[model samples]
Target: MTIAIIGAGVAGLSAASDLKGAGHEVVLFDKGRGAGGRLSTRRASTPAGDLRFDHGAQFFTARDTVFRALVSDLETRSHVAKWTPSRVSLAHTGGTWSAEPLRSDDDWFVGAPSMNSLVKGMAEGHDVRWGERAIALSIRDEGRYVQLDTSGWQGPFDAVILAIPAEQTRELLADTSPVLASEAAASVTAPCWAVMLAFDAPIKTGWDVAEVSNSPLSLVVRNSSKPGRGNDETFVLHATPEWTRANVDKDKEKVAEELSGVFCQMTGAGAPSLAAAHRWLYAKTETPANSPYGWDHAQRIGIVGDWRIAPRIEAAWQSGHALAAILID
Candidate 1:
């Protein structure tokens, strides 16, 4: 069977890996320049030096047997390592508390060098098209799946898996699967603005990660402290969903300026040496689909992501694995 998995993120890559292991020929496609959708990392110029920031899905956890096995393999290659973060959660009522949920001796992990490396390692020998955008998905007259890309229509596959966000998959599959479309469309997503800042000199921020409250920012993470990143006082400041929604259409520079000022005030990090901003329009799903994955019974189209289950890397991997198993069975 020829299986087409859309979105080279964790879920898509995991599905492709599992399907191939089951003796099915698989092809993975992603619109991003690199794999690992939310699992992104980038280098930025700073006075101190070049710093790396994981601007997307920060870190991942292992919960399932398959994911554990995969992580074990990644660990062997030095593509991932354990990370203990000092997490602080803010209460809705304006109270704050620090906990060690993210700091574990045995259950936390981050991609070595960068989170995207894990996906790159997973996609070693797969047929992955990094810059290809899947324009359409359909079931042909003859019981076969077909995917339309920017170049042309390519298909005649036995099965298709969509591992992107629910909203995006909904847009592509609505014509062929109204039921799947309706369900996915109903699952609204939250947005977030990540403000990346680089400092010229080391700032005296006592903690590596700080959870903020009653402000536009949600969490602030010190990127330089991560295991595999370079040594520079760089930070990733994430805005609250409410703030991101309110300022979605505003100019990027203005948003960056405003957030940088707020971050300096919050942490007393001083003026940033360099700054950049990113908007995750579908940062996470507002509501879950009550299942780990979505499938069109008659169309042979399957959708899976963290939004399909819980909002986490582990959930995304598990959802993809389950969907591929069901499709290949």
Candidate 2:
């Protein structure tokens, strides 16, 4: 069966890989220029040099057996590496800020060069239509079809899988399958504001990653501290969901300035030579779907994403893999 999988993120790529491996023809479509939805990287030009930031997901852990095996294989292929950054927890106390050491036994893994490299590696050898947004879906007498924003309607595939965010899946399924659309609607997601900072001199914070409390910012990472990243004294700051939702409409420059000030105050870092901010409307999953994946046998339509389980790369992989397993069965 020829399948149309939308969204070239981890979930979509995972499904496509498995289905194609099972002797089915699978094609993927994404609106972005490349794969990796939340597992993304941003490049910034600075006087020091070109800086790379894993601004989306800092790092991911593989608990499931299947995901662990895949990660082990990627590590052997030089596409991924274990990240052991010095960790710290910061909290605001009575007129003072306190920092405590954070320790975890669970292994953390990141893409060798950038977070998106993981998905790019998984998306190898697949027919992926990049820079194409699937705006609508149609059902003909032959099979299901998808309408791309640029390339008209394409398909007559046996099945159509939505591997995008919950809201996006809901919108796409509203007309095709209302029941599946309602399932997508049940999942809730939150927004995030990310700020990338590059400095002329390195900030001597001692710790590479920090989890903050009682602040607008949630997590701060020294991007250069990660493995395989060049030495460029770069940092990525992620704002709290509440803060991001409140300031979602603010100017990007202003958002960068405000977050930069917070970074300086927290770490005593100097003004960044380059500061940029990005707004992610569907950044984090607050509530997930009831099942691992949603499938409507009558319409041959399905939905797979991290929002169907937990907000983790492993969950996203598992969701897609689970859907493909059922379909193959």
Candidate 3:
């Protein structure tokens, strides 16, 4: 069978890998210049030097056996590592976020160099057509196809699999498949404002990570504190979903200044002289479908992503894995 998979992220690539291994011809497309979607790493050019941040996904935890085994294998191959951060709380909810002597135990894992590295490793041998954003969907000559922005339609495939973000999936298929696209549109995802900063001097924030509230900052972490990264005094801050949604339409400069200010206030660190901000419209899932994946065998269409009931990198993998399993069956 010839299959067309959209989005070269973990979920899409996972499905493509298994589909091809099962003897199906598969073609994958991603809007990104590289694979790994939100499983991304941002490299900032600073006068001090190049600072890399796992800006998209801070860290991922595995609670499923299949995912655990996958992580273990990645670890054995040196693609991933365990991160035991010296976690801390705000201590005072309303007041300043000076870190106190409070710590919590958690098992956080990060990709060896960056979170995207793991996905890139997983996509080692797959043929992913990059920068091919699917702009529309259609069925012609009784075969499924997606039209790319520049290249036009790409398929007459036995099946079309949408592994992109739910909102994007909805936008692409809204006209051709209203019911399916409407379902995709119904999945709720939160926007996030991520600020990446490189400090001239080492930071004095007492803790490496903090869960903050009552302020614009939602989560703040010293990226330099993570494994493998040199002690470069780098930090990444995530704005609360509420704040991000409200300011989602603001200009990048305004967004960066405001978010960096809140980060300074929360961490008690000085205003960063160097900084950048990114907005993720589908940053996190607030509500998702009850099913792990969706497939319409008759229509030769499948939708698989992390927009299911469980919203995590693991869930995204599970969604794609389930899609491939169903097709093979």
Candidate 4:
């Protein structure tokens, strides 16, 4: 079977890997410069030296068996490791706390080196085309199936999987499937502003990360504290959803500055040597689907993502792997 899966994120890659393992020819496409959609990582040069920071999706938790199995396998391969972060909350002043990493089970793992490495492992040898943004979809041969961005009608493909955000999947298949489009419209996502910063000196905080509330900042993490990061002082700061929404239309630099200021205040830190901000328009979903996965029209065109279950990497993995099991069956 020939399959086309959109979005090379965790969900997409998981689906592709499973399909490939099932002996199906798969073509995965992503609009980004590389894989790992929200599982992103970036390198920065600070006064201290070069640093690698993961500003998107600091870490993931597992809540499903399929995702747990995948994590166990990743653990064996050394693709992931346990991450223990000192956790703090903003609900109090001069108060601090700590806890274990969020996990589907007792064991939790982070991608070795960075979160992006997980996507790279899933993308080992699949036909992935980066930088190809799918524009539209057209059904050929009278209700057989659809092809993306073209109308020549070459395929009554065995399957088509949309592993992206619901809105994007809706946009691509809007004209062809009204019911699906309407369902997607009902599941909207929230935005986020992730700021990556690098400091010249080591952070003085006793905790590795802090969860902030009632402020512009939502979470602040020491990037160097993660498993595979070197001795550089890098930080990842996330803006509150309300803050991100309020400042979404502002200039990128201005938004970064505002968030950076809030971060400095929260941590009692000074200006960073380097800073950058990324805005995720549909970053996190406000609501989630009732089911762990979605299938459509003879199981030929299925959709899956974190939005299908819950807004987390575990949800995405579960959705993808569950869909793969259904397909294989």
Candidate 5:
């Protein structure tokens, strides 16, 4: 069967790989410039060599036997690496910073070069169409397909997978699958504002990763310390969900200025050499997914994503794998 998977994220790419291994043809589409979805990365060139930043997910843990094996294989292939940063949770309560006790003990893993590398490796040897935004969904000739915003309708596929975020999925599949659309619409994923800062001079920040609380900023990560990043004092700051929603509409420069100032105060990193901001409308999940994945056998429409399971990189891969397994079976 030919499968048209939307969103070249981990989940969608995972589904495409498994289904192809089972002797099925798979075609993938993504609105983004490349794959990996929230498993994103940013690269910049400065006088201090090239710099990299994982602006989306900082790190992920492997728990499931399947996922553990997958990550191990990636590690063996040098596609991913173990990250053990000096992490501490900080309470910014009362406008002061206090180090709190660590919470989780699980080891974190990140892409070797950047988070997107993991997914890019997964998408290798696949017919992936980038910059293909699905504008609408339709069904005809007893098959389902999506109408690209740029390229008109392309279809007659055996299956269509909605592997994008919940909100985008809801908007795309509202007519084809109303029930799933409603569920997608009901799911709550919070927005986030991420700032990537590159510094020319080294700063004396003792820790590599700091999770902040009771403040507008959420987490501060020293990007240079990652496994395969440049030696510049690069940092990434993530805003809290509440703060992101409140200021999501603000201009990027304005938000960057505000957060860069807060980061300098928090870490004493001094003024950034260069800084950029990005807005993720659906950054993280606020609620857990009740279902691992959704499949309508009659409609031949499947839905899988991190939002379809627990919020994490593993869940997203599992969700897509589950849906593809069911379909292939």
Candidate 6:
């Protein structure tokens, strides 16, 4: 069977890998320049030197057996590694900041060189059309088809799987399947404002990761503390969803200034040599679709994403893995 999977993220890549391994012809289409989706990295050049940041997702944990096995395989292949960082929680009260150790038993993993390396490794040997946004989906006398912004309609496939965000899935499925579209609409996601800071020298901090409260920042990570990252002192700060939504329309430069100030205040760090901000309209999932995946077997159309189950990276893999199993059956 010829299958077309849209969105080359973990979920889409997971499904494509499984379906293709099962002897089905599978192709993936993504709007991004490459794969990775939320598991992304940003590289910047600074006067100090070159720096990289895992700006999208800091790290992922594998709670599921299947996902753990996959992570183990990637680790063996040198595409992934375990990240052991000192974690702490910061709180502000009466204009005073206090820090406490944040402990977790879960094993945290990150891509070897960058967060996107995991997805890029998964995307190997697959026909993925990058920068090709899927604009529409149609049902014809022949079979299901997808319309791309640049390439027009490409299809007659046995099935079409949507592995994109919920809002985008709704837009594509509104005409193809109203029921599925409504399901997609029910899922909710929140925006985020991320600030990447590059320092000439390492900041004096005992903890590598900090969860902040009573501030505009939610997470602050020393990106250089991760495995395989260089000696550059880079940090990634994620603003709270509420803060991001409130200042969604603010200028990027202003956002960077504001967040950098908050980071300095929280960490007692000096001004960064380089600071940049990235806005994610749909950064984190708030309300999921309450299902592993949505499959309209009669129409041979399905939807899978982290929003279909949980917001974790493992959930994205599980959703796609489960959906592909159903399709293969």
lDDT of 3 by residue, 1-329 (tens): 99999888878877987899999999988888885678788888877778888788888877778878888988888888888777666644656444545453546788887888778777777878888988877787868888898799877888999998888888877776676787788899999999888888887766788877577887888888777888688888888899998998999788888878777766567878688888888988888987888776557788888886566888888889899999988
> Which candidate gets the maximum lDDT versus the true structure?
6
Model 6 CA lDDT for position 179: 85
| Model 1 error, position 284 (Å) | 1.6
Which has the higher TM-score value, candidate number 3 or candidate number 5? 5
Residue-level error in angstroms, candidate 6, position 22: 1.3
Q: What is the lDDT of residue 310 in candidate 3?
A: 63
Off by over 4 Å in 5: 101-103
Please give, for residues 1-329, the per-residue lDDT of candidate 2 as tens digits. 99999998989888888899899999999999986678888877766667888889889998888889989999998889999999999887775668999999889999988998898788878999999999999988999999999999998999999999999899989989999999999999999999999988889998999998899999999998989899788899999999998999999999999999999988888889999999999988999999999999999999999999998888899999999999998
Candidate 6 has its poorest 10 consecutive residues by lDDT at 45-54
TM-score of 1: 0.92
Candidate 3 yields a Cα-based lDDT of 0.82
Give the per-residue lDDT of model 1 (tens digit) for 164-266.
8888888888787888888788777899999888887787756677777678888888887778787667888899999999999878788889999987866
Q: Candidate 5: lDDT over CA atoms?
A: 0.86
Clash counts per candidate, in order, are 0, 0, 0, 2, 0, 0
Q: How well is each residue in 1-329 modelled by candidate 4, as lDDT tens digits? A: 78877788888888888878999888876878886688877776655666777878888876567677777777788777788777666543454323334323344467888898888777878888887666755555543344434333334567778888988878866776676666677787888999888787887877787777667877888888989898778888888789888888888788878888877766678888888888988888888777766677744577889888778888787778888888887
For candidate 4, what is the lDDT? 0.76
Candidate 4 weakest lDDT stretch, 10 residues: 96-105
Residues forming the 10-long window of minimal summed lDDT in candidate 3: 96-105
Question: Clashes in model 2: which pairs?
Answer: none
**Candidate 6 residues 185-260, lDDT tens each?**
9999999999999988789989999999999999999999999899988999999999999999999999999999
> CA lDDT of each candidate?
0.81, 0.91, 0.82, 0.76, 0.86, 0.92
For model 4 the local lDDT of residue 46 reads 54
RMSD of 6: 0.9
